[model samples]
Target: MDQWIKTILEEFGAIGVGALMLLENVFPPIPSELVMPWAGYSVSQGKSSFLAIVSAGSAGSFAGAWAWFWFARRIGKERLANWVDAHGAWLTITRDDIERVDHWFNDWGAAAVLLCRMIPGLRTLISVPAGFANMPPEKFSVYTGIGTVAWTALLAAVGLWLGKNYGDLARPLSWVSTAVIACLFSIWVYRLVQQRRTGSPHKVR
Candidate 1:
């Protein structure tokens, strides 16, 4: 993974950042933690502009979000739920989180879509619930666009600052990002385990 990221940084640079962000949103396994920082470092190296990199990343994120939203809208809740139950591993969604998201979507309406994008793991997954709830297309796009751009810009800034200390920062930044990803995955796994053991649902909101 490290070698792959380094290669992308060396070759495509900021464009790689955008592509990876899109993939990250659509696929979840592609870590934006690594991509954003690399883009930041590239900016520091004068390889790319920070604003441009953020824009590309945000665009990719929006595309991914839209894809999920459309899927939800088309499939409807019962069908999507059955499909998720059959192929749960690939989806990475929990019944509890789904229930909670549904409740929030019902209570908050279109506003929940914007708020959900601000949360870490919830950002991409929220689109699914929004779609299922039949959120207005224009509203979803507007809120998602605002949130995606803000989040991407924030991460890019962090990357740019780390890039300033390129020699000393690279190793530490790599470790930090790795640790964060590991922790997040661990939490997700732990939640799954707890859900299984206790047969309790996850609550959203």
Candidate 2:
């Protein structure tokens, strides 16, 4: 993976960093923790500047987020609610739950989207709720951009600090990413079971 990342960074420069970060948002398995820091390390190697990498990465993340946002908008709330009603048991969600979530997102979406963008597992998923709530694109972009930039800068700084030791941290970072995903899945499973047993949606809100 390191070789692949290095190859991409070497071949495409800042564009590769943006592409990787875009993919990282669209596909959760591609951890931004590794991507941004690695890009930072590349900066250390004179492959690119820190600002360029961070800007590109932030742009890519915003694009990926917008993709999901538009997708939810395309589906529309009525259609999504109907599907949830049909598959609520398996999904452990209900139409009422969807409405509740929509309301919650409407109320706190700005903060939620901003804060979640800095979180490992929740970052990508947060965009979905924002979309479902029909958040204004301009507002969503503002908050998402602010958070994404901050997160990207922080990760890139880590890479710069790691410097020659970046390789040493790769494995540990991968483990951390895997653990976060596992923990999120575990929580979902627990919620599913609880909802199933009680015949009620488990409210995380």
Candidate 3:
């Protein structure tokens, strides 16, 4: 992952950061925790601008989230519930569970959307339920942008801080990325096992 991200950032600059964010949302395992910090590191090296990187990341997040939102919108709740009923056990999702989520969305509306964007695994998944519940696109975009920009900024700030003393850690990042990935993977495995055993859909990790 480090090598792939490094190659892209080296080759593509701020655009690469945007692409990485897009990929992270489309493929959740990629993780913004890894990508965003690297972006901040790049900014520290003067390879990219802070505003540019943040904007790119936020845009990528919104685009990916929007795709899922549209998909859920197209599927509609009835169809989704049918799919969830027929196939959700393996996935550990239940019809009632989905409704519970929908009700939550109904009550909280855009605020729930905003809060969920800051969460790690739920960030993208929440968009689906929001869309399933027929959230207004304009309202969704505004809150989504708000939460995404704030979260991405926090990640970039971490990277910038690390960059302040990056000289000694020149060779440490490979292992750092590896360690981060490994931890996330382990957490995912644990959750999958738990989900399968319990026959309930919980968070991915």
The numbered model that scores best in lDDT is 3
Candidate 2 lDDT, 1-205, residue by residue in tens:
5557767888998999999999988876677877887788888777799999999999999899889888888898778777776666655566776676567667876998898889886678678789877889999999999999999999999888777655555565556556755775686788788877876553322
33-142, model 1: which lDDT tens digit per residue?
Answer: 77777777778878888888898888988898999999989988777666556556434565555668788788987777777776777788889889997888998999
TM-score (all chains, Cα) for each model: 0.86, 0.73, 0.84
- TM-score ranking of the models: 1, 3, 2
Winner by TM-score: 1
What's model 1's TM-score?
0.86
Q: What count of clashes does model 3 give?
A: 1
List the candidate 1 regions with Cα displacement exceeding 4 Å: 89-92, 165-168, 195-205
Tens digits of per-residue lDDT for model 3 on 29-135? 78898888888888888888889999999999889999889999999887887787777655555677677778877898889989989998778878888888788
Q: In angstroms, give how far residue 109 of model 3 lies from its true place.
A: 1.6
Question: What are the clashing pairs of model 3?
Answer: 92-201
Better of 1 and 2 by lDDT: 2
